[model samples]
Target: MALHSASVNSKLIFAPAGKESHGQAEQFTRGILTRSDLDQTSPIWQFHKWFAAAQRSELVAHPETCCLSTASLPSGRVSSRMVYLKELDAEGFVIYSNFGTSKKAQDLSTNPWASLTFWWEELERQIRVEGRASRLTREESQKYFDTRVRGSRIGAWSSRQSQVLKPIQGDAGDEEDDGRRVLDGWVKETEKRFEGEENIPVPDFWGGLRIIPESVEFWQGRQSRLHDRFIYEKKAPTEESVQEWTLERLSP
Candidate 1:
């Protein structure tokens, strides 16, 4: 274990962290995991294995970060962005975003279906999740919102995220610097606006979305350009029983 520290609002926060690389790339052999090795009941459990491995591997940074892709219905316009996976359970995957600002949010509003991808390049593994996205309850959103860093919480309130930004006028020479100056000004203003205010409420337009998976596929790299692939697909719910899922191996 190793010790690490971070400063937030002039307060020091310390924690332990460590992940060491084992050997040279050339020395590491290709990974192999067939369907027999996969969890047959719940892909969520299978995800736990890969996720834990990624977290332990030195090459994996931000293992919880995944690509969330949403498509606008009929038009088929698709957009994707990296979002931190905040929660994962028997329910689904959870992430927070500005509900009204981002195109991805808008897309999900129109079409609930979404696709998520988690790629651990160093481990030669990728997991794809296809599911329907739904807004989390107000209480759930608030609970998680309270855990975010102060600046992030303020950001959810300030600077309309994903909105078209106005270009600065006049000769600032360096537009990038001028843009940052304006943003910093907004941050300061927001901080003051919330001064002495405890428990900054979650923004009405910002909250969490949970993806309810219907199908999930896991891929592992192997030799000779062949790969190991397995999928767990949710079966249709019967009137007498709840939702059930089945696992099957897929052609590489």
Candidate 2:
């Protein structure tokens, strides 16, 4: 007997044994959605308060950014990620990343405009920001890095982010070593290799970026999909006059 198969139009549905099926799967996810159902307040300050409270629990949250940042790599492709919001004040949202990192840094060099988004799953809240990025001084970066635990500081040195990793011969058991052990081992090894060095220096590649907001929008999700939005916009600065910010309510 001979093996046989049937085809529908030009596509084949069956294949020989051991052949694997190839296709893409649909993805579905849900969140409390905003719709045209609830009463929206004219004053946005009310929603802003709620949004700020939801973010207060964690400085580093996903779907959050000091602002939206887009960068074009050397390969001419754009990449984006949620960078940690390190500080926020009257000035704007503050964040830090390596100057050598491929995303926002390179783009900031040419174009400074950026945007950020914050979404709270539990409370059904979201905040969007548009801004310009400015590099923080080395002093500021060093100050923040110094405040970090010693292990974090060492990890900063060990991680060459956005770079490939190479497999090497070493005791795999070291993978389970604690931060203190790794730091101590690195220090001892450095001292031995460098003829008794006393301290390890901070790496030059690490630093921070500060995003100055030009506009900020806060969103609140309500029952039946009606959502609330409030936006703050700043006027451009002039030589004789300082920039000013105004708040407005937006239709959901």
Candidate 3:
């Protein structure tokens, strides 16, 4: 079911926690979410708190990963992919990737809107973000690129992400092996070309995108299929410096 449907049925629907002979499900009573514990002044702070908690726990290996969804403007059919959330601020969530390369990036080009989901199964918590995707400044992109390892930085050049690869030419042991050799050649060449330079050239198409959230929702699983759902929606843009936001609990 959609999170914000006009039907006014905000209750969450989930199959019981298990696949049983009688289709019975396990109840999730692991955690409690209260408005008193969540800060209304800033949803970002609340998000940081939850994210920090997840990071500190041994249960999470990579808490920064989030699923990002985007659609082609004309078609409206959406596609989702896992991306690492590299940065977060009052502005919103940030992720870096090759622009105009992957299908998701193409979708974002046509339709700037995006939705992000961060689910920590161990914590039974999820955060959903709806926003517009906009490119980061060149300086911002370069700054992050500087922090990447040598091989990954070179990979940005060697890989034309989501692009179809050409069939390897000439006689070879096997097709897959030939393709691997071809890729390795590119990587080797890239490494050699940048060996002398202190700063390798960041791919012109590689950069970051910030999801400027229109709304952010936090969910916590509860017992008897009741989940805590709270959403913070931006009040709207104005001439003022600080944007206002409204927080409310959805019936779940």
TM-score of each: 0.82, 0.62, 0.86
Tens-digit per-residue lDDT, 83-163, candidate 3: 999999888899999885789878977889999999998898999999898999888999999999888999988887887
Give the winner by TM-score: 3
> 233, model 3: CA deviation in Å?
0.5
Highest lDDT among the candidates is held by which one? 3
lDDT of 2 by residue, 117-174 (tens): 7766656667787778777777878878777766566656655466544444458665
**How high is the CA lDDT of each candidate model?**
0.84, 0.60, 0.86
Off by over 4 Å in 1: 1-29, 170-182, 238-240
Name the candidate, 1 or 3, with the larger lDDT value. Answer: 3
Any idea how many clashes model 2 has? 6
Give residue 101's error in model 2 in angstroms: 3.5
Clash numbers, per candidate:
0, 6, 2
lDDT computed for candidate 3:
0.86
Candidates ranked by TM-score, best first? Answer: 3, 1, 2
Tens-digit lDDT track of model 1 for 112-170:
99988998878888999999999998899999999988889999888677765554664
lDDT of 1 at 51: 93
